[model samples]
Target: MALKINKTAVKEAKAGDKPQELRFEDGLILRVQPSGVRTYYVEVARGKRVRIGRVGTVTPAMAAEAAKRLSVKVMGEGVEAVMPVRAITLEKFIADVYEPFVEHEHRRGKRTAEDLRRSFADLLSTKLDRITSRELDAWVRGRREDGVKAATIAREANQLQGALRFAVERKHLKVSPFDTWKAPNVPQGNVERYLTTQEKAAIRKALSDRDRQQARERASANKWRRERRYPELPMVADHVMPMVLVLLNTGMRYGEVVKLEWQAVNLTTRTITVVGEKAKAGRGRIIQLNDEALKVLTTWRALTNRTTGLVFQCDGEPIKSIKTAWKTIKKMSGVENVRIHDLRHDFASSIVQRGGSVYVVQKLLGHGNVSQTMRYAHLADEQAAKAVALLDGHKRGGR
Candidate 1:
């Protein structure tokens, strides 16, 4: 029955077998449940109902006030106007807005965009505003449960946070959900893989065997081409071995090496310039080439017969990947559990073991900070001990 609803009427409301609705003017309702729990609801329109709060929490006066305001809003501005502020879904925002901005702004933007999309796949469908810090914690816990490395998880999380921050900057979001999120601690002393002497020798032998095999294959193909009167291909048909040598010697990142152009190479100075745009450090640096590296590049340059364009290209296009070749090389060499990137680590380790300072290693590796080079500090410690032992030998001679 419709009646004048007040605090006393709401407080004294009783429940029976079914829910009892105490209706009032202006479409305000106090619903009393079977267990005697009362909640305030408002029928802003004829069929639509909106829950305000419970009776104890939302008093009759407050419910009445809210109902009146909602009614007035619906009458003047329509139902959509009274609805909560809508936010775009995370996936939609990233694909439509953030990614496009990143593509225009950053060199590796496409890769970064793809990584974020893949990493935050679970949260893609969720609305941006609904993604709280608690939600991120659950996501991180899920990743941990899936056995994803802490460092990898931290990197992906940071990328997602960066995308959200970009959204806020572009006015697509009010604030980033990850603004207060703390990344899980990554073990700083986690040592990188350094190839052993036997492994190194095995890899070199494998490369030599592979190069000989390739030479024979090239000769056979050239003979077939000559018979068909087609143009003979170059001796250096692929970039796999030469690129590996450069990576091992120069400690150049895969991207930097792939993007390297002939213009940056100085045969006289035996140095190669890593352009800032292609470099991870965002600043250009010159890398001095050792005898093996200089010879490899010199032979590669002569064989390819190119004075300009990418150092590693296939059919005049940049080589996308050498995964298959690297895998084959590893298998042939019996080198287990070594990643292609580990060659860079091996390069740094060689210097450290030879008593080169971490500061020098940092500069050679183009690390923005010395802390990155500190992962090889243990190797330096061994070198330091060896140096100190030489002083002991000198003291013995003096005695």
Candidate 2:
């Protein structure tokens, strides 16, 4: 190891190949700091060192003894739990330890992995050994104080916990500091909101108006395009009634509905089977086609390529997203609170209101749990009311 010395002492010691300010030679490296304090560091390891203690005065003998003691302590602390420099540096650990674990959890969606990745992009670049637990605690505390949702903060904290656990397993960290960190409280309930019958009718009506307007605009545009002798008009019906009908008919998610394959869809049996990892639940389910859904499917199938292998593809590529079209449709339909997932809610609600049981609804909706199926229990309650009325009528007739 080496000791740092103040300048005046070095000049007095007739130091060779060293600055005059460096008074101490053994176990210390010198820096004439901007703050004017002669800071002291012990060279505990080769090319790696720790600041032992600062000595303002240039005392060579006293500094050497201090450096020797501090070096021994730093070395001892690291022998058991404290991580070495190679393990805790900014560039040293992120690529090696953190990102891979986050990505692995992301695949299974144990949490919102991508969101966590974005949130931690710069944060994890900090050196673990240099960063105090108090700094991390304050960072979390600041986020909470900034009006960020408690639930969101809790999830982020959980992700951090997972990262720390991974570090601990590799001994880069001694223990997960967040093992006892509390997450925000969340309430229980599967409360759902659905479009009323009138609301549903108004939306469909408004969609029709929007589709007609779109058709007119396309016709005008096509007239202009045809002057150049194009093979066909570029007028598309993808943003029309056919699309809305497609979503309402099949309770399939916007993503799933847009990416259906003709080979997977059995038009003869009016069944649509979807199998892909793109599903949020990561499981495929069979979609039953009603008359409205079937008609739309048939029309779409005939309108697109008979030679092409894929169904519902536009411009020769399978549709990946329809969010823009949905946004336009919602505004046209006059349903401000509507979401694409609400179409799914609409399907389950329709099934339940039309005398389907919760179990049937569960199967139709492809929910993993029955608790998710019970929000439609109110529909079954309607049947009980009908039964009660029938019983009252029979009792009166007997009297």
> What would the TM-scores of all predictions be?
0.55, 0.52
> In terms of TM-score, how similar is model 2 to the real structure?
0.52
- Each model's C-alpha lDDT? 0.83, 0.63
Model 1: per-residue Cα lDDT over 1-399, one tens digit each: 567779789878899999999888778998999998999988876677888999778878899999889889989998756654448998898889888988999998888887776667778899888889888888776554333557788888888888888777766677687767776564333338789999989998888888888889999999999999999987765688899999989998776888899999998899999989778647788899999999999999998889899888988877756766877888899997776677888999999899798999998999988998998999889888888899889898995
lDDT of predicted model 2: 0.63
The number of the candidate with the highest lDDT is: 1
Compose the digit string of candidate 2's lDDT tens values, residues 1-399.
Answer: 333544455334433343333424444655445445555555555666555555546355566776666656766775333224345853455566666665575664434444454445445567654445565666564453222345666767776666667677777765455654444354322325578888788878877787788889888877777887766566666534666677777767665665566777888999988774645366777888899888877887776646336666667775544556666767776776565667777888888787878887777667778898898898779877887789888898995
Clashes of 1: 0
Clashing pairs in 1: none
List where candidate 2 sits over 4 angstroms from the true fold: 1-191, 225-233, 276-278, 306-310, 318-320, 390-399
